[model samples]
Target chain A: MSASLRKFIITRILLTIPMVLILITLVFIIMRILPGDPIRSQLGPRVTEAQADVLRERLGLNRPLIVQYGDFLVEMITFDFGNALTQGERPIKDELAEKLPATIELSIPAVIFMAVLGVWSGAYAAKNRKKPVDYIFRLLSIAVYSIPIFVMGLLFQILFSVRLPVFPLAGRMDTVMLVSFDSPTNFYVIDAIITGNWPALGSALAHLALPAFTLGLALTGVFVRLTRVNMIEMLQSDFITAGRARGIPERRLVYKHALRNTFIPILTLIGLQFAALMAGAVLTETTFSWPGIGRYLVERIELRDYTAVQSTIGVFAMFVAGISLIMDILYAFIDPRIRY
Target chain B: MNDTSPLVQIRDLSVTYKTRLGDTSAVDKVSFDIRHGEILGLVGESGCGKSTLGKALLRMIMPPGRISAGQILFNGEDILTFDDKRLRDYRGRQASMIFQDPMTSLNPVQTVEQHLVEAIQVHEAQTQTPDATGRIKTLLERLGIMQSRLASYPHQLSGGMRQRVMIGLGLVLNAGLIIADEATTSLDVIVEAKLVDQLREIRDEFGVSILAITHNIALVAEMADRVAVMYAGNLVELGEVSRIFDRPLHPYTQGLLASVPTTEINERKELYKMPGEPPNLARPPSGCRFHPRCPAAMSICSRHRPGLNEAAPGHWVHCWLYQDHPEKEEKTLKVAA
Candidate 1:
């Protein structure tokens, strides 16, 4: 509401535009520098130089670096990413359309799992600080945080999918469907329910549960530690004391005074963690063979699909920047002090 | 003024903090009564347990700083025996506290109206008061904040304004006894003077007993009706304001008085500083805590501690200098008063 806050929001929004462009440009340049030729790789090792050159020319790779970059930038501005060299006439948008939903399906559920479990654990640990429960949660967080996500994903795959055999090993759904549905919202859960496929909806949730939980386990420690540290510090603040002095209920003080103050920092951390989650999804997606962007990027990278690699990374970077910007704007709403 | 029942009766109250090294006494057997409608000044040096005593009275000591032993009777009911819920119920309804840091004492994320409304709702939840919002707005206006500030956050206010908001928060609860622990220590002198004057006026208007805790003797002199001086962890002296300034009897009280520079001097003069740092509470001196730096220390002063005893009709002193020594009893106690 203040003039300074208005100026600050405008400045933050303006600053984000250049940041997005620079990050995308950097990803674009770095992809070119990495050792690989998309056209040559697509032609395979047995192809002749003549064939590779023809393919390269056809794909616009024969142009000068600046001209190629300029053309790509212009195309990107129009939101019409050209066909993938490897896919041979398949547009990048089509690949994204198939892959983005799967990635969101995995990541969004994982984030929700992390937020609920992690925040509760953190709050509990802070409330029972110095006790056995606190120590146990602290050690659990440390162990979870120390283990590599890929290793944990493999372990979960072995235990939950292969050994126990309670859930599907890989893929979004089974072949023989008791009920069929159109992908209206691109999310199976919503689309199945919309099309009146109750069994399909149930199956979809069951399929999502394991991978989501696995990834959630990987992420929970981060939120736990972040919220724990912030909440502990917030508990000592004079505002909490004032709340107590005002005779506000202990539960109210804990929720209102303590947790709310910790939100700004927690929000900033959550935004950073979401970006990390996108990067980490490559491993989870590949391990599970879930056909998400992570696996798409990995498979493309193996075949040296440079344009696909660069564009995918660029899109993810843009997503990260956009979400963070939105969060920074929301920061003003969460904490009035952040308006400026 | 004729009410003889002490609003707050603290007896043999002692607080100790359990540090990693050892237990340190923050308030040692410091006891005093706050009479109704009277402003009692709890004055001492920075580490002299004035704030500790005030907090102990409210049963608000934080972790590790436990009230080792005490009886703080508010309205003849000992508050230390109350459970958490009961204590909370009694906290703002019967007593409330205003902290030194107004900026931090308020939730910066909340609006002024939200803060006041919370306090009002906490204490007056059962009251059928349709004028609650109006009353809050009027209180803020009286505290010099405009109607627009009701919707403003703590960060939006100036330091003086934040302090006024904190004061308004303490009073809005309508507690019988208000403990202001160095409430104006964070403000400019002029603002502090204005606020304290405003606080005194509010006190007079509402007939609320106030425990005004500050290290500034001058501020205490201006606002408090009676003064209690603490040293280390002891309540060394208590008397009427006039007696405290005009006839301080205790050696520690005299040292505190000497340390303060006279404002009337106008020209800059070398102020008398306390001779040494306060003794460690974990291992205080054998005789008197002030004996190490006391210029008037005698052989007996190093061997035996003194007790708080009546030196005059209303003045109390805690030093061996006014002891019943046949050689100097009459003259020493008489001259000091």
Candidate 2:
């Protein structure tokens, strides 16, 4: 890389450090401010006030709020997020390992689906602007976007799962297979394939289908609309007109030439959407009873498991921040015009 | 000079557009022929419809715009009659165009070689097998582009070089007639002159013809063999370059010539620029459209439109001064007034 590019990357990384800290601090503060006692939620109604106070002291929850926050920050820097409150014995990292992958598996397909279908439909709409195809796509996108994710999730489950037994609903996999593998990675699909458990892999995907489709449909609609609008505007740019005048094939003109230029802003939208999905997949996960982080957050929040909630929020926040950074770097690489 | 028919013979062509506002005439009864190995200059102001005329010849007019009436006869066949398949074959094969802006004309994601190769592959599919890499390098070199620059995008190249690349794409197709629509207008004056010179070299060396559309009179004076001046979508004057410049007779043509700023005015005045803007084509003035702006406007001009008649040897002008018998003699005397 040139000196300028190196300087740019360095600058971006440095800037992101404070942004990450600020995010973590905010998550910590917000979770603390909400009325919830991690000790009481852990001990349950059987515990006396004395037992609750002892548990609070043991967990360092009795310290002043600023001191507790400072300690939490120091621990987080070393990647030690202490222990889970409700379970008492389990590490927060272990809980995250179980829940994070499930959420990711569910969300990844939806994201990929949104990107491919959204970009394609958007490009088509742009190419056929003001025509019937453009109008139909526009209407479809708006219709899909107008529906809330939870409503769409419920609707898809009703129509596809309950009404018709065409798909298996809920759970990561069926109980029938004695499919246990050496955990090379935490992801079940990868582990299943590694252990030569085809049935297990098939079952996993089967269970994944409804949630992916529902979640994907909801987000893809918005993506398609956003991308289509952006691509349509870009199509009218002078460069596109010039390409047409040069006798470029219509397909190449729309896809390779026009769409690629539309990517910078579109990718940014996709990144922010992925961040939102990490937190916002609650409705989809709950509807499907999928064991994902989004559903886990809702369950913990309802029971008022403050430690689990804070740690989970912190982890999710970090994931989003990390993805956004990667996207920023990618943007700089793809279009040199977008230097920091 | 060797025996070969003219490359393009645009016959009594007219074009109209159905805009949201109303129907507007873009090209009206304009007729001209471009011969082989000669550069024909189409000159006029921005709204004079020179670019529209160029697009009409190519049959590339988009929707809301249509050829209301015209015959663009390329090699004795009217292009307007061609269906989609035949038109596709004709475009980029027999004739191609280089647009004004080089930046937007190119697709950003694609490499330079990919852009040129696609154009070549499309039109030259029937002939020799496409050696994509070889042809691209050869064409780029012919247009004076460096070999290293082949991998660079349009944004990477200078404006002048990008136009050259655009020109190179046209050349790769071996097109007979190249319509360069204000092709050099976006470049610096020096670069514009250089590119035009390079274009002249290409025409001379390759036996290709060019329809160079521009608003700059000096460019036409330097580069064109024959010049046609358009006013409000109508061909007001057509002649050899020397005849049109030395003895311009049409009032609009006269006004356009006088408008060119020259230091030789000797502090006489700022310049003899014609007063008034181009008339609105949607509701253009009656009779001659130039009458409102014509310094020598007469009552006859506003009542009856003049026809282009050969006022001098091989020169055509649509002005009342060149119309009729004894009145022509009387008008010539009155012209001095």
Candidate 3:
């Protein structure tokens, strides 16, 4: 990479620190103001005030506000959430390491599916313009985009899992495969492959199918519409006309030349839609019983585990910042005019 | 092909656009011939269909606008009837175009060398050796872009350099006819002058015919061996440049030339500006399209359309004033009598 790109990356990473910090701080404040005390919520009313006070002191809830805030920040920096006050008093970080990877694994294939299928179909539709294929794609995109993700996940489960038995209804993998293979990375697909166990890999992928598809298919419409509009506008550009004048095959003009130019804006949209994808993941993980961060976050929120909630949000903020940074660096590589 | 025979004969070609109002005929029954090795300047005001006519030669007009009639015969082959396979072989290999606004003509992300090489490989990719850069390097050098700049993207190059790269793209295919549609309209006068000289050198050295289309009358005079003037989708006057300059027959042609600012230094005289805009092509005048704007419009000009007549041996004019209509004249005389 050039010196300028290296400098851009460094500055971009530096800027994310405060962004994540602010997001975490807001969560901390909201959790405090929300209508319930953590200790009261976790312990029963049968427990006396003296017993509650002792547990509060143990959990550092009795400390001064500024001191508690300082300790919270320090703990966030170290990524050590001590222990969950509710969920069996499990260590928050230990639980997080497993759940975060599952969310990322589901999201990786979901993103790839949305980008590839959406971009390709959009370009195809633009090339066909007023034809029947174009109109069909236009209608299909609207139809696909309007259906809520949770509804789609339920539908997929009924049609593919319950009725046809083509896939597992929920979760990341079957218990049989989970116990058979040693999941070192907590990513079943990776562990299955490394173990050279093809059946385990197949089972893991089969279990992943419904949730990933529902998650990905819900977002494909946005990419399709974006790529379609951009491709149509790009096709009218002078370079495309010039390319046609040179007798380039219409296939190459629409798919290769015009599509490449449209990607800078598409990359920006991809980065923005990532947050929406994560929001959908919460519903997806709940409907499918996938053991991911979205489900974990929901469980913690229900239990009013304040420490777990804010830490979970902090990790999300970091991931979002990292993705946006990657997108900016990608823009510099795609468009030379943006190198500065 | 014989030198005397026209290289490309455009016979009664028309291009129309389907608007909500009606079909707008941009190029109307236009017929002309570009001879081998001749630089024909096609001059007109904006929206007068000069660029449309240029694109028609290459069949580059997009949808909603299409060739409604006429045949384009290139080297005796009618390009209008060519299938996808033949059309691909014909473009860039036989004829190509250099568009206006070089800034937008080349892909922004693509390098200069990549533009030229793609034009060649589209038709002849199999025969292309690894050293395809051999021809590309030589062409860039001739266009005044250095070998080092070959890897540079369009944004890195200056405006003049970009235009030259466009020119190189057109020439790299060794095409016989180059339709330069206002190719230098965006350039500064100095760069335009240099490209003009290089274009002339290009014609003389390569023996390639050119249709230099622009609104700049002065540039047309400087470079065109023959000149064709279009007014409101009508080819009003066409002849040798010297003849048209010395004695323009059509009133619209005369009006166009008189509007050009010369270095004569006439005392405090304002330049002659034409009276009306080019008509809305969808609903042009009933007869001659130029009648509303013509300085010497006759009473019959609105009622009767005039054909392009050979007023002199090698000069053509489309006006009732020059082409005598004895029968129409008698009727007009009786009205006066």
Candidate 4:
């Protein structure tokens, strides 16, 4: 495996840890939310010592094997793990607050950029099928799709960062820019725009362009190939011909009619690919050295801080779930053939 | 610019599909004319190229399929020579086509209103005018669709409603020629009958020429003013709908009528089922394409193709059974004897 991809699987593991933790939490919630609330009643203030010991001894007997997990979901929420990233007694929230936003600031545009460009080029390729432009696009999509993500990131870093010197080589921003940057919410770009800090926005965006594009470009070929295949199928459909017969322009028939018809399947793929990218960001983050949750979770694991680890995983679960839920809702909106 | 010359005259038109193996002649040298304000039913079995002939009139044949030879004259102008811009104006303005399978014909994502308005916008120059909206609502209502259904997508509508929506799209631009190509085959019998009435209503109200193409003889009988029967890309018989249906001259047409299961006790005797599958267009029979399946096949049927002979007033048949023909072959008479 490529070094960057090896780390990506590791990051995927990091994201998946949250999923496993969430499953455990779901069991806890199910136990807690049970019709009679048996566990809560068992640990009430007046319980006898014998009963307590019996309950403790069984380790949740009468429970399925799957339900015997620890419950520190509350502690994970409070988040008081100290000195994980820094020298002495610094709160883990402080580290997370800074790193998580950097990852997100880089990710949002990457996903949007890749999806738009991918669909546009894919539709273009389908339109020009068997032509020189179509062949070139098909070739480029395959080439781009097969190359590993980290390798492309490194190559781009060498070209854009080292040789060309147009962007920052590593980190979210320059030391000079970082010193003056104030981010309470920790989302640098959003914070910059809201504050009307044009220079800070420029600095953040300038630093962002390379890694975001590299991250986006890596996954773009997948969208292109998918959209092209579906668009070609849709273009031949009766409605497309119907549109043509109605004197609807060929351009509208393609981009508006045929493209929208392909969206139901493509939206599903987008939802899946988005979740995959969000959870599988370890390598891209490592190559660009953007301090995100993947690195933090690794450090917490090294220190054997179970509370920090579980909580971070819980948060990651929510982010991925939130994105997928939004996508599915968007699916209902895009395709009238189905309801939520 | 001849008003009396027929709204559209298709002369020697042929559409050939270029497959990897060879060219398949889908519509071969078929000549016909659709006059103003008439529902001309084109009936044939599957693969007879009736649909290809309909698409050919509008120059709507896609790639791999080309109009190899012929002229489609609309208002005495050759549509085959029209450029892209002219073709666009010609379509949906001069002519439009309603398709088979309404389930797959209307864009699922667009509402009925959007479908109608955009179809008009292609020629109307303005977008979303109250004038267009009012016309669409009125037309949909006239087609028996409720005003509320106008906002609904195709999937929300029944098969019959969707077909009506398709008709609305074709009519919104007021095209001179409307090709209903197997337009109601996917619907149920009741829905098909209802749509047939609506089609006749459309012709009566708009006075626009319609070329109704279908394989269902009963449907063509109900809806068309005149019927043209095709067999293996050949026009075998054509006349007034009653004349053609009552006394079909060609053997293929007779077989087609004879095969239809009727409910009348007297007409419920042994049905004539056609013996063979449709001939492969890439390698058709030497003389008559239908000769192998033709129950009344003769030596001349396998040796020399028959030309059309008018058997009765306004009734034509392409068959060797009819004597008076203009063929130059001298040996056909001896063989017939």
Q: Write the per-residue lDDT of candidate 4 for residues A1-340, one digit (tens) a residue.
A: 4575456546655665566565647644544344532322346657786776675454333454344333254445455433332233256667767777877777788888888988999999999998999898888888877788789889999998899989988877677877987877788788888888888888878878887898788778888889999999999999999888877889999999999989877787777776667644666777878777766665555543433454566666657756665665676678887663
lDDT of 3 by residue, A1-340 (tens): 8897788899999999998988888898888888777788788678999999998898788888778778778988887977877757788899888898899889999999999999999999999988999999989999889998888899999999999999998888778667767888899899888988898899889988889898999999988999999999999999998888888899989988999999998999899878888898899999999999999999888767877888888888888888999999899778877884
Off by over 4 Å in 2: A1-10, A44-47, A178-184, A336-340, B1-4, B125-130, B265-270, B295-299, B325-337
State the lDDT at A157 in candidate 2. Answer: 72
DockQ of 1: 0.69
Clashes of each: 0, 2, 0, 1
Candidate order by DockQ, decreasing, is: 3, 1, 4, 2
TM-score of each candidate structure, all chains considered together = 0.92, 0.93, 0.96, 0.85
What docking class should model 3 receive?
Answer: medium
lDDT per residue for candidate 1 within B1-337, as digits (tens), equals 2478999999989999998769998898877799998999999888889888877776789888999997999989999999988898778778888899987988978988888888888667764444677888777766677888888899888778888887787777667898898999999888888888888887887778999999989999999999999888988899999999987877778777877877667766666666778898888887777778776777677777777788887777787776665433332332211
Cα lDDT tens digits, model 3, B86-135, are: 88777888888888888888899888877877888888877474466888
Model 1 earns a TM-score of 0.92
Error of 2 at A324 (Å): 1.6
Cα lDDT tens digits for candidate 1, A1-340:
7788678768877786687678768867877777877875677789888988888888888889988778767766676677777866478888888788888988889988888888878877887788999899999998888888888878887898889988887767665762355675677877788888888888788788877887888888888888888888888889888778768887788777788888887788778888878877887887777788999998887767766776777678777877787778788789877646
| DockQ (Cα-based) for each candidate | 0.69, 0.51, 0.76, 0.65
lDDT of 2 by residue, B262-295 (tens): 7675667655666788887887788878889876
**Candidate 1 chain B weakest ten by summed lDDT:** B328-337
